[model samples]
Target: MFTSQGPSLRELAVQALSSVERGYDLLAPKFDGTPFRTPDRMLDAVEEALAQEEGSFGSGLDLCCGTGAGLGMLRRLCRDRVTGVDVSAGMLAEAARAHPEGVDLVRADALALPERLWNTYDLAVSFGAFGHFLPAERPALFGGVHRALRPGGVFAFPVGAPIPVTSPLWWAVAGFDTAMRVRNAVWRPPFVMYYRTFPFGPVRTDLERAGFTVETLPLPPFGLREDGSPRWRLLLARKPAAQYG
Candidate 1:
């Protein structure tokens, strides 16, 4: 998927060898040209789904927003304000350049979001950034998200169905994950990205533990798998509004 516009294999290898934040910094300028950027169709599907479900939002947060891919979608979905947060300064710079007028880009770690942002957003969403977090980090990451949203606000993201053992894609991802493990083992700074680490069941549990009531809705555009399950589902986790007794 590397066009002349995209990063070459050697550049990608250099990025892979660096830390996650630094790697993303190096990849920022051409991030949108790379396959790692979320596809437009997936963004449109999510925007459409949220439009149908929540109707609208006051303020929205894009968690681990890489190069502001989903910022425009959040802008249309949220009437008041839209913010994109990521740890990489270079990615933020690219996002700012692309979305100069309407978007607010923040440089911050997703796991330890600033307290100033607590209870600030009415909706939160992330795309293709889960792999950076280990399963152990979900609690802190989710708790931060849970705290970021206003009571009754929803956090939404898409999850693909597990690849069956029979699928060649499954073997490919497995091998990729194995290679990553080996690389991290030998590397100085660990770049914690794994394709198979973010399973829905455990992630749902983590969300529940972080005080979100979670549910899933099928994203029909991606179609169904052989067993009739949706190939891609939108995971909607909502924080319960406070009660006045």
Candidate 2:
């Protein structure tokens, strides 16, 4: 699923063996050519949904903003400044090159943002990076996002419906996770990407524990499954506008 301009199999193999940060650094330059980059259609769909729901936002943040794929969506939705944060300096550099102006790129771990960033943003969005976080890390990740957003601000991301057990995609993901487990057992600096870990039920619970009121809206453009459920839904988590003593 990669173009000739994308990383070669040997490059991808090397990346899979490296630490997440270093792997992304090696992958950053050729990222936009790979399937790993967030699809433009998905970005457009999310931007449309946010524009319709919130009209516009003051400032925006993109979490784990690898190569700043979601920066364009933030630019369309935010009237003020937009910021992108990632742990890989190389990815941030590539993002800066691509976006050039009207966006700020920060190299930082998303789970532990700087205190200066607390309550500073009106909206936040993330795309395609959640798989890199293990399930146990969700609470801290969501908590950091909650603390980064201003009161009444939104943190939104799209989640796909679970693959059916009968589907080939299910077996493919299961095999991949199993392979990752075996690889981590034998390898140093585990890559930490898994397809099946972030189900909606557990994710909603973590978001609630992090002090967000959560709801969802189906992205109609992706259409429905044979079972008539949405193929994808946007998770909208809102921090409360007021605090009670």
Candidate 3:
């Protein structure tokens, strides 16, 4: 769902046909007006969870940081500096406009970060960006986050409980994913956004392989589901202390 200020149908059609970077560039200006931006309530819960898990960080990084929505959370959790990296220059420009003072916006692909960034951050985060990545790319993306963090540093994000397969919401998401697959089959530069692609089990495995010790904490503020399971959980993963020079 989108607000009145969100992208028009023509604008959405344009974005859908472009490459992911260009699509996001076209979408950046009105991004916050869409449900695509992580909600403040979820952001607050993530901040609280980070505070409890890691206490505080010296410097923070936001991977695929779209329009710097998560920068405020990074600023609250980190003491020194907060950097936002994105592949879309348009998105980075918007981020610069929105977070002029406290944040640094870098235009770079998360899969191909600069060596100078390695081990430069104490905390790394991403919000509402994973769907853009294919499942096979998770290892590289997580590895980049690991590379960006200092030893004992963290990479955190909030993940929601899976929609029930019996529910209409499930059918809706499934149909959306199916349509995306069909579109990709017939299109160039596929827009890779799938809801069910990044399940927690495989994600934890990828994080572990990328050298992170992972844990999940319930976000109670978002409340529970019918079975008393949390509607969402915050993933807290730490890069292990360096073993050798």
Candidate 4:
């Protein structure tokens, strides 16, 4: 599912064996050519949904903004400043080259956001980066996002509906996760990317614990499954405007 401009099989193998940060660093230059890059249609759907929900925002933040694909969406939605934070310097470099003006790129782990970022953004969005975080890391990850936003600010991302057990896609994801587990068990500096770890129910619970009031909006462009369930929903986790002591 990669273009001719994408990384070669041997290059991908080398990346898979490296740590998450380093692997992404190696992959950053060609990241946009790969299927791993968030699709423009998905970003468009989210931008439309967010505009309908909250007409316009002030400043915005993009968590784990690899190659800054989501920054354009933020720029469209936010009136003031737009920031993209990532752990990989190489990714940030590519992002910088693409978006040289009207965007701030920060190199920092998503789980441990700097205090300067706390309460600074009116909106925050992440695209296709959650798999790198383990289930146990959700609390910290969500908590950091909570702290990063102002009161009534939002943290939103698209989440796909669970694949049916009978589907080939489900089996493929399951196999990938199994292989990742096996690799992590034996490899040094494990690359913690698993497709199955971020379920909607558990993730909503974590967001709630992180002081967000959570809700979802169906993205109609992606359509629904055979069972009449939305194929994708945008998770809107809002920090409350007021909280009692």
Residue-pair clashes, model 1: 0
Candidate 4 ranges beyond 4 A from true positions: 243-245
In candidate 1, the residue pairs with backbone N, CA or C atoms under 3 Å apart (3 or more residues apart, or in different chains) clash, namely none
Residues 1-245, candidate 4: write the lDDT tens digits: 99998999999999999999999999999999999999999999999999998899999999999999999999999999899999999999999998999999999999999998988999999999999999999999999998899998999999999998999999999999999999999999999999999999999999999899999999999999999999999999999999421
* Candidate 3 lDDT: 0.89
User: How much does candidate 2 score in TM-score?
Assistant: 0.98
Task: Provide the global lDDT of candidate 1 against the true structure.
Answer: 0.93
Residue pairs in collision within model 2: none
What TM-score would every model get versus the actual structure? 0.98, 0.98, 0.96, 0.98
Please give, for residues 168-226, the per-residue lDDT of candidate 2 as tens digits: 98999999999999999999999999898899999999999989999999999999999
Tens digits of per-residue lDDT, candidate 1, 94-126, equal 999989988888899999999888888989999
Which lDDT tens digits does candidate 3 get at residues 1-245?
99998999999999999889899999999988999888888888899988987798899999998888889889988899899999999899888998889888888889988888888998988988898889999998998888888898888899999888899999998999999999999999988888889999999999999889998899989899999999999888988887211
Lowest-sum lDDT 10-residue window in model 3: 236-245
Better model by TM-score: candidate 3 vs candidate 4: 4
Candidate 1: Cα lDDT at 114: 90
Residue ranges of candidate 2 with Cα displaced over 4 Å: none
Full-model lDDT for every candidate: 0.93, 0.93, 0.89, 0.95
Residue 15 in candidate 1 has what lDDT? 94
